[model samples]
Target: MVELAETVSDVARSEDRKEFDALVQRYHKQAYNIAYRMAGNHADAEDLTQEAFIRAFRFFGQYRRELPFDSWLYKIMSNVFIDRLRRKPKAMIRSLDQPVVTSEGEAQFDVPDNSAGPEETVLSREMDSRIQAALDTLPEAFRLTVIYADIEGMSYEEIAESTSTNIGTVRSRLHRGRRLLRNKLKSYANQLV
Candidate 1:
């Protein structure tokens, strides 16, 4: 594993044509998952992941060697995601009548849902949607903190490092974020019972 990392590092440092491509192959899914959680949709997640990689490649020369590369990539992704949120228009204008098409020339919206219809699956999806809505209500810092620490299963130190904050701040954000979420979800819980 160390040798593989060293080889990747050497390749990246030498600015080989395949450096970014190799990175994409290794970390694209991880980046996309983070983006998906942040953006709350597949299309936006794909766009965000692509944009983040572009930015990372552009600034690759300045990347610190001391940090884990994945963490560094995630920092770039988080920054790009935040910038997009800031600059995004309050509303977008698009024709709803347009057909959605995939890269394979297939109608995107025509895909069939073949998943199991178990009672647990239905309840889980409902709960997930409600929780995601509650998460969206948080301030960006708290939201990201909660997602990184709780959903992504990152340690407190990792969350702090990823967010460029101290561990105490990470703990504070998680505590406050969870409190807010619990309060927001209380009504839904009552209904469930």
Candidate 2:
């Protein structure tokens, strides 16, 4: 198989949309997974992934071949995710029981109850939700570090490059993040018992 760097070079030199699309096809699912973990929802994850690819396409010429393409792409995605968070205003919290007046009529938020699933499935989902909630409580820097290292299984060097930080910082953040997650999960386990 042809190397991805060669494909990147082809796109960079020729501005070939086809080559870029191939690259996108190869990495889209992984990118979306990262975005979903970062954004905490499907809609925001989709938007983040789209924006990241758009930016990557716009700046393909500047990509250095010495580094891996996925790491570079991830860097761009992380920046886009962080930028979106910075720009978005804090959302106003509303009760699900409260009714909203719409053009047609009044409507209340319909929250899904996943408690009706099979016992094992419900337990698995509950654990996943608890873990995600713990991740959400982390600061962005630590959260990104944990996601890249633990969730994505990226190497320390790759994470350092992706986050534009030294390996020491990545290690520190990962350690602290994992510690926080352990504590939170332990607390949740205790509550359940």
Candidate 3:
């Protein structure tokens, strides 16, 4: 197999779509996983992943080979996710009693009950939800740090490069994020008990 750096050089030198496609094939799943964690939904994750790759291709000339390709790619992904978040409007809360207006007529929202699963499955899902909720509560920097370090298993140096921050900043954010999550999860456990 050609080394990743060589493939990147090929693409960079000639704007080779084939080499870039090969790079995408190699990193697609990892990139999507990061996107899903960042976006918190499948649809948005897919869009974010696609946008990141598109931007990466467009800006491939700016990429420095000294940095790891994955880290550089993740930096692009993070920027895209953050940019989308900034542009997104705050979510509006709607009362269940209120009827939704449609072009044809007024319509009632159908809310599904997700609590009908087996006890073990329900508990597991609830735990995952609580963890995700805790993660969501964090500031974007801390959240991304936690996700990159813990969930994606990126090293401190890699995370620093990805986030465009120093290693000390990454360490601080990870520590603070983990502390907040621990406190939040402890409270949730108490509620369950």
lDDT of each candidate versus the true structure: 0.75, 0.79, 0.78
Model 1 Cα RMSD, 1 decimal: 8.7
Tell me the tens digit of each residue's lDDT in model 2 across 1-193.
4698887777666755666788899999889878877766677779999999999988877777687779889999878988896686644544334788899899875545433447645345556666766776777778888999977999998899888889999999999999988887885676443
Ranking by lDDT: 2, 3, 1
Best by lDDT: 2
Residues 1-193 of candidate 1 have per-residue lDDT tens digits of: 9999898878776774366678789999778777766775576778889999989988876777676779888788778877885676533422223467778784523323233466536355556656766776777788888888766799998888788889999999999999998998897776544
Clashes, model 1: 0
TM-score of every model versus the real structure = 0.70, 0.72, 0.70
Clashes of 2: 0
After superposition, candidate 3 runs with Cα above 4 Å error: 1-15, 64-67, 92-123, 189-193
Which is superior by lDDT, 1 or 2? 2
Q: RMSD for each model, in Å, please?
A: 8.7, 7.0, 7.3
If ranked by TM-score, best first, what sequence of candidates would result?
Answer: 2, 3, 1
Which of the numbered candidates is closest to the native, going by highest TM-score? 2
Model 2, runs deviating above 4 Å = 1-15, 65-67, 91-123, 189-193
